[model samples]
Target: MAIEWKGIFPAFTTKFTAADELDLPLFGKNLQAQIAAGIDGVILGGSLGEASVITTAEKETLTKYAVEQVAGKIPVVMNIAEGATAEAIRQAKLAAAWGAKGLMLLPPMRYKSDERETAEYFKAVAASTELPIMIYNNPVDYKVEVTLAIFDQLQAYSNIQAVKESTRDVSNVTRMISRFGDRFSLLCGVDTLAMEEMILGANGWVGGLVCAFPAETVAIYKLTKAGRIAEALAIYRWFLPLLELDLHPKLVQYIKLAEQQAGLGSELVRAPRLALVGEERTRILKVIDSAIATRPVLPDYLSL
Candidate 1:
């Protein structure tokens, strides 16, 4: 399966059984919905998926399950978040073994590395895997910015094809296109800025809230790219509040809560990560519910 690496690729949240185990059946259900909703691709073990707490075995299981459920209807890209080069390489091979079509490779997990070290980390991982890679660059969350200079050095690797741009600075989108000139495919990684990024020529979207609203997400991407600004803005304006949830630190909790409200999956998270409760829970739910109450009717083109 050749991943275009363009359009809506949900950084899908992982589903857990009430006992906090991998809920394969339930997770598969969500993956199927993403495909049926016409998303471009699906990503597993991402930040929204609680990658920090999930073990290697669990990640492999998630990768294999996504491969099985998607069944080549779309690409299942595995996300590799590791603390060392060797570990990142190991996991990249593991994803290849599980039949993942692509990899979303992040910088060193905890320790922030300098430009040289970070470029080397990505290079080493690229050397180890045959799978096409999308470098995850979330400076706000990860604290290590894969600056344009670092990305320039990365241009040497052919398989290091795309970037998940989460610098949170929309101007960076223009800078990437101007400097790289399509040398690299740039996917907008921030949900709130998806519209602005796409308008600025982001090749695709590495989305967070798409876990709950796949159709709306795809509609926004398709509409924007089609030059349907009026139609896109209608949806983007309505979606802005929910999209803001992705910017929150507890984005997993907020997104999972939205998924549950949207009847997609359970909000059960792993230990050390508890479900939302009391005021926080109510606050998030109010936002989701208000969106549901006044959700806009989909454009006919989107229904296709």
Candidate 2:
């Protein structure tokens, strides 16, 4: 089936056992929760999923695992973030071979390439694979902004179907809609600005917090799009604190912590990234606890 890049697509964090091994069963459980929550799709091996620390072989395994677990229920898009164009092409091919329905391709990792270099890198990968690609434009964390001019150069690739707009500028959503029209689907990648972008023109949300609160994420999208703005605003206001967690440098840890609180997954992270501790842990918990203590019950209107 052709995957629709037009709703909530959670960039899931990789689940690890205490020994730091891939916990495929735990991963499946979280994915099942996403399916039940009515998320539009799933993205594995993105930055939130510890892509830098994961091996290409592991990602291929994850792509296969997600495909099997989802069993064609929803599209599974694998993320490709490599330092070289050839490596990116190889990752894209590996994902396609392993049954991924789509690919979220990042710019050449490690080095900060100029716009021309970045466009070339994307073109090379797109030319090598038939899978639909969501070009991730996260300059804040990735140091690469796929600017409008760069996108203008890439619009010819029909396989380059979408843009994960995490430039942190809400106006970028409007700019893309104005320039590309229906040519490129815009996915809001910043959790904080998700509502704003969606209200403007984003076709979907490539989310982080959805891993923890999938239902609420989907509800927000559905409600807003259904012209139930007041209802969506209430949930968005309640969700704002947790959504802010996705914007942090240690978002993986924060999100894993949230996942544990929600009984969705473990907080165990790979080496070099430890569980939160000290005042940091206490500080984050204060916000989470308060939100939980007063968490709003979803109305029947959101049952969809």
Candidate 3:
């Protein structure tokens, strides 16, 4: 099946032992749990998984492992963006060659700083592969905006199928949908604005916090899709703290800790990216406790 980029796609975490090498066993297990929980797809090597710290070999291996583990149960989208065009192409080619269902494209780290430059950059990367690509409009961290002009131009490419809208601006999401008119599937990259964006017109969500609590994320999607707006809002209310955490500079550490506390994955981030400790660890644990307390109760899992 051609993977649809139109629903909850968990930007899953990278697991590690206390010693911190790639924990493929834990990684595969977590992927399985998310799939079984009813996620539309599994996103490997995304910010949620600390893709920036990992080497190309690690990304390649994880992409291969995740794709194989999903085994057509769900779409497996790998974050193939790099600071350099050559590296992005390398990751995308490797993931495509390995049978990943899709690629999540983040702009080059150099930051186009403007629309024409951004358009040119995306065009360059889009020309590199035939795999369906989801443009990651992560202006929150990237400082790069996916302006309407840029989206209109990029949509001309058949492969630029979806976008991870990281902007919190509602007008931006509404404007894009109005302009493109289903030409692009806008996935919520910012957790806080997900409900609002969906209310406006977003088709899906892709973010760091959802990986630690897949069932809750899936529940929100199911409820919303079924037209149960009140129920979805209640679930969304409980997820607010998590939405706030995504705004923090220490987001990766906090997200990994939540996964660890949930018995999902390790908070073991690679070096240069230090371990969460002192005040940061305490802060994250409190958030995890709250998420566990308010997280939706689901079948086949522990009660919230």
Candidate 4:
């Protein structure tokens, strides 16, 4: 019930060049701005950062660059999800080499795997690195779910220090905390469920929309932590439409567009990932606009 971690840890968006290379300079600037805005840390290349489409080498390169830029000002957690134990291990080692402070690992998924396979995968990856690791449980999109027993089996892993529970089930978040208590930190993954998880006693949040609105996300976490329920709800309800976008398949596209509109990052995602356009674009804007109208005032970067 007592933990020092507070405020937002924005799942940072990646900046891309016109040709779609990672724009690390812009990324560094964004990270610095978030820290200045009182964010807790930066989550590099999570769902918001579109880690799935990027290459293995690209993940390593981006992870390396982010660590250097942040320069230990705050924590930097690298996403290390892949299809196999070998690849995850390789990436974890590289992230350690790259100076990452923590590792975020989603369940191993390329196909359906049984309990043994899932447990072993996490065990292997956990064995590979000493950096504090957070289990990224995003079953809806990844098509894999780790049961509570899996967490029970892995409690022996000291480095497996946190969890980004994206199951979108507040009960599961509460259940895990009830079972494990402070054994593992609970990180709310779905932005729509942030306040609920925080209210129920989650450790922190690993957010996607923070790519577009780090200050607002940080404010949400801070208010929740301070027990200012009405104030936090005011902000959360205002941003409900944007958080709803988290459920869509083209979330990264919309998130990047939000960043572009805010002048924080570019919308140029890698190939096989197209930008939101036409009717889709119009609908998303309407959602964002309605949320902005509900809010008292838009944050400076999100204005115009």
TM-score of each: 0.98, 0.97, 0.93, 0.92
lDDT for each residue of candidate 3 in 1-304, tens digit (9 for 90 to 100):
4767777888887876778788999898788888877788878887777777888788778888887788878988888767777777777788888778788888778655578877887887788888888998878678888788898899779989999898778777888877889989889888888888887889988867777878888778777766778888887888888778777877888887788888888778886778787886787788889778766754332221
Give the TM-score comparing model 2 with the true structure, all chains together.
0.97
Q: Where does the lowest 10-residue lDDT sum fall in candidate 3?
A: 295-304
The lDDT of model 2 is: 0.90
Give candidate 1's root-mean-square deviation (CA, Å).
1.1
Count clashes in each candidate, considering only residues at least 3 apart in sequence or on different chains: 0, 0, 0, 0
Q: How many backbone clashes does candidate 4 have?
A: 0
lDDT of 1: 0.89
RMSD of model 3, in Å? 2.6
TM-score of 3: 0.93
Q: Which scores higher on lDDT, 1 or 3?
A: 1
| Top candidate, metric lDDT | 2
* lDDT score, candidate 2, position 1: 56
Candidate numbers, best TM-score first, in rank order: 1, 2, 3, 4
Runs with alpha carbons beyond 4 Å of true place in candidate 3:
111-113, 298-304
lDDT of 4: 0.78
Q: Which portions of model 1 miss their true places by more than 4 Å?
A: 302-304
Q: Which lDDT value does model 1 have at 202?
A: 95
How close to the true structure is residue 302 of candidate 2, measured as C-alpha lDDT? 46
Give the whole-model CA lDDT for all candidates, comma-separated: 0.89, 0.90, 0.80, 0.78
| Model 4, C-alpha of 156: deviation from truth (Å) | 0.6
Worst 10 residues of 4 by lDDT: 295-304
